[model samples]
Target: MAQTEQRAAPAAPAGHSVTAVAARMRELRASWPPADGVAVFNNVYLTVTEEVGRNIGRRRFPDRRGAATLDAVFAERYLAAVDAVAAGRRPPACWRPLFQYRHHPGVRPLQFALAGINAHIGHDLALAVTDACRLLDCEPAALEGDFHRVGDILERLEERIREELMPGPDLLEIVDPLTHLIGSWSLERAREAAWSAARILWGLRELPGLAEEFRDGMDASAGLVGRYLLTPLR
Candidate 1:
């Protein structure tokens, strides 16, 4: 997507509201250049948050509150990272690559988008699930339905992103390095891993030290994958 003329940053969201999150995404999209890696991811994520909001409004989820809470909490993780970067602080390890490479001209838009997805789904989503569980006073199982519903939306959107952002056949041959690089990551597998991590994190909730260590490991591992995903293929 082409970037629009720069505009003022939107107001920070007052709370965990999906509408507010979507607005913030729009603001970021308007403020950043189209070629920026973070902007690329933000555009994709904006579409997702909008779709999720619509689903919530249409009563797609059996538990509306749970779905909304989960969506907002999940989005907050990404937005907070954006805030941290703007404040000259380091974001979580999983998000470091995307922010670090946001302006690299060699990274394709699709690569940027996928790297962001990997960081969010691979690391942030797990933590978000546990965060939501704590806020809602429930176990991970209680939010399983909502989690899958959100994942389903993400899966469909990911397919669309690939279809839209993939380079043309003439530009991308069967043995193209870019093709192989992009193919190395899978959203399905990431989502599965995130779900497992969420369960484990939830189980270790009582053991704060162990949970923190596990969370740190998850963050670092996801960051590693994200760095690879953003590998310059041009």
Candidate 2:
């Protein structure tokens, strides 16, 4: 009799239309419904991560332009979401064309930085898992085995992230082989992760254009998705 192997179930699909998702994000800002903020911020992570898998699903992986567009949307939106988390205010500034999605003020660039960092997290997760799957996809049957190692690596990442430890090299085993990929670290141990996390958020201030773009884009993109989280000042 042959032994069986176990694998991670494919990640779930993104739930909303891109524009609908974007629109709902705006509604979160516009209404300042705390629940909505959490929902959209969660969406930020879900959409970006799944988008990566979906890219693989398409098998054509978007060209640089589409990728950039997606990146811009992610960066812009995540920053707004983070600022809302920080300021104890709602997130705002969403955009589309031919209309102002949101026009709130007082929260700006931090929002954008927040958006970018969050996007980075989501992208990295997708890159890791998708590549992990791709790697499993490539191995010869004899060499092929359980995705348990993959699951273990991912679970370790989640735990270390919770504990704020610099995960050992095992995650590299999972994500490193992808064409071009990188992993994130807590920068400090568990006791320091929360502090480092704040610093990490603060450090984002140093990134080129993060401060300014977040400020400007928060309001500009309001019509986009973030506006839903705040009350639009008329």
Candidate 3:
């Protein structure tokens, strides 16, 4: 598949609103070929963001503003990475694997989808929670409800993603490496760890040096997991 250039929309004055974020995702989905790893991930994430937006509109969250704020901030991290790659700059470690292997023919679409999820949920979610707290002038505890609600949405979507993307038995053997690889990571577990990391990051806010170090470590760790998830199965 030929790679298409993906340009991110300008950041909103207050950061990207959910609507703007969704629009940018839609643009990427349209511009990139379906087989492109980033587009594969973009489609799944777009569905997740759209669903979250609907839930927020229906007042499903106790703190609607907080949920929206968290959702937007979380999305901005991914978008920032995309923007970086588009501009020929290096993205964060957590996002590098997907961009680097996006065109690899040996990797399956399912791996592409999960790799993106691993980077976003494992790395971006924690930082987003902290960012949202700072923007809302609240603590991580205040956003806990919103955090879980968003996570609940992601958990549900992950099930659907697996069902929709998993290869048939004819295409994948029982002992395939992809099977074991997929089984190794769990979105639910990732969410739990993300929540813990968010609280830790919030605590480290008072120590900039320690906080940056922790953030860098988290990014690199998630990127390593992403690389594992994208391991070619063919």
Determine which window of 10 residues in candidate 1 has minimal summed lDDT.
1-10
In candidate 1, which residue pairs clash? Answer: none
Error of 2 at 169 (Å): 51
Give me the displacement of residue 5 in model 2, in angstroms. 17
Backbone clash pairs in model 1 (N, Cα, C under 3 Å; residues 3+ apart or in different chains), count: 0
Tens-digit lDDT track for model 3 on 1-234? 112113222232386487888989999998999999999999999999988887777667788788888899999899999999999999999999999999999899999999999999889999999888888889999989888888888888988898899877753676778888999999999999999999998899889999999989999999999999999877
lDDT (10s digit) by residue, model 1, range 1-234: 112212222222246678788899999999999989999999999999988887777667788777888888899999999999999999999999999999988888999999999999999999989888887788999999999999999999999999899877743676887788888899999999999999999989889999999999999999999999999876
| Per-model RMSD to reference | 5.8, 19.4, 6.5
Worst 10 residues of 2 by lDDT: 1-10
Any idea what lDDT model 1 has?
0.88
Q: TM-score of every model?
A: 0.92, 0.24, 0.92
RMSD value for candidate 1:
5.8
Q: In angstroms, how far off is 91's CA in candidate 2? A: 5.6
The segments of candidate 2 whose C-alpha lies over 4 angstroms from its true place after superposition are: 1-36, 62-69, 87-92, 95-234
How would you encode candidate 2's per-residue C-alpha lDDT over 1-234 as one tens digit per residue? 112112211332233133344455455456544333243334433444344333323433333223323323433344455556556765442322101221234222223222333333322222222223333333212111222222233344444333332234443455432111222222123212222332333345457477445445434532433232222312
